[model samples]
Every structure is written in structure tokens, then in C-alpha cells.
Target: MQPTMEFLTSEEAIQVDAALLSSKEKFSTRLAIYALRCLKQIAAEKEISVEAVTAQQVSDWIKKDENIQQQLELDSNFELFFTRLVLSSLKPLKQIAQSEQQPIENLTLKQVVSWFEQESKIRQE
Candidate 1:
């Protein structure tokens, strides 16, 4: 298993938001929510704090290949579905985040909070 993160950066959250293709602002807000949930999952499984997520951890989570169609008795491959979604949605953020070369946990809290604050202002406008 890979190490996990405690939080999502603003850019990463945006990437997830874009991936969802949501039409409603409320739906788009789920990006941060889902990321935190994923971080919690990773933290629980790995016994790590959610604050120290790594690129590798996020990558590993995204690559899990859930295959939920098999679960629901459908003939479709949910694993492939998620794989494509991660590639299309996260690749750009992954690239950009890594280019900075700073620690993942280092910039996460303030940035995520700031992103939310900015969004809140926009929503209130």
C-alpha cells in the first residue's frame, strides 16, 4: 500500500471537480468532500494521518480499478471507468503539482481552505 494524504490542494480539488462534469455548484463542491473522503479511506487503511498524503498515494487510490459493475451484476467494468476518469481528470493536476517540487502536506491545508473561502465568496456574489 502507498502512503496517503490528509488534505487536497486547491488545484487538485479543481481537477477532481472538472472530472465530475457537474452542472450544479453544489455538485462541484463535492470535489473537496470526495477528496477528503478518499484521504480518510487511505488514512484508515494505511494507519497514516490524512495530513501527509503523497502523490503516490493519490495515484494508487485512483488506480484501484473498483470494477463495481461486477458487483452490481452488470457486464460493464467500473475499474476501467475509474481508470479513464483519473487519467482524464487528474493527470494535469498531477503534472502541475509535481512541477512545484514542494511537499504535498506542506501546502495543503492553507490552500484548500483558501480555495473554499474564495469559492464561498464567489457563491455569495
Candidate 2:
């Protein structure tokens, strides 16, 4: 059976902590690692983290508009995958920010991008 969101969230949190601890040597790479870790949490909940989604899956979700396709092409699949993951997680993060009277924009996008890029590199290595 698939794991619940609670389980996945906890796992992702652990992954993030590990990435942060090991990131002392490489700041950007560490951020990308943590971001990808967060994305994995969303992907796990969405049932897509187990395997890379096929082109057909992408086709089904994305618009047919040439402009949209062009924009999406700017990022590699690895990047886009984590982008989706982070975007998905943003909803709850936004809620928390609002509840705490903080700005959602204050959230660390650079760190997420960095963690995503780093994790992708590690996987490729």
C-alpha cells in the first residue's frame, strides 16, 4: 500500500535534515537537494515519485499551447519534476505563512532551486 501524506512528509523532513547537515561544503547544491527532497514528498503523495512520469503523462497535464510548451522546455525534466513538487507543497506553506502573518514570498525559492539542481546532479552521478 502507498504511504500516507503524514508518513511521506516525515520522510521528506528527514531527507531535508540530512541534506542540510551535509550541505556545509556546497551551499547551492545543498539547497537543491533539500528542494528535491521536498518535491519527492509531494510526488510520493501524488503517486508519481516511484517512477519518472512518461511523456504521455506530461502531455496529458500540460497545455497544448506552443507558448506554454516553450516555457516548460526551459527546464530539464529533473528540474520541472521538482518544480511541480515545490509548487504542490506551497499551498500548505502559504497557509502557514498567512496564519503566522508572514509573507509567503519570504519562503526560500533559491534554496529550493539549489536543492533541486544538486539532487539532480547527484542522481546523474
Q: Residue by residue across 43-65, what tens digits does model 2's lDDT show? A: 45567631354434433344332
What candidate 1 gets wrong by more than 4 Å, as runs, is: 1-24, 65-125
Model 2 TM: 0.26
lDDT of 1: 0.47
| Shift in Å, residue 12, candidate 1 | 20
Expressed as tens digits, the lDDT of each residue in 62-113 for candidate 1 is 5562533233244345445543443342332233235445533233433444
Q: Give TM-scores for every candidate, taking all chains together and pairing residue i with residue i.
A: 0.38, 0.26
- For model 2, the stretches where C-alpha displacement exceeds 4 angstroms are 1-76, 106-125
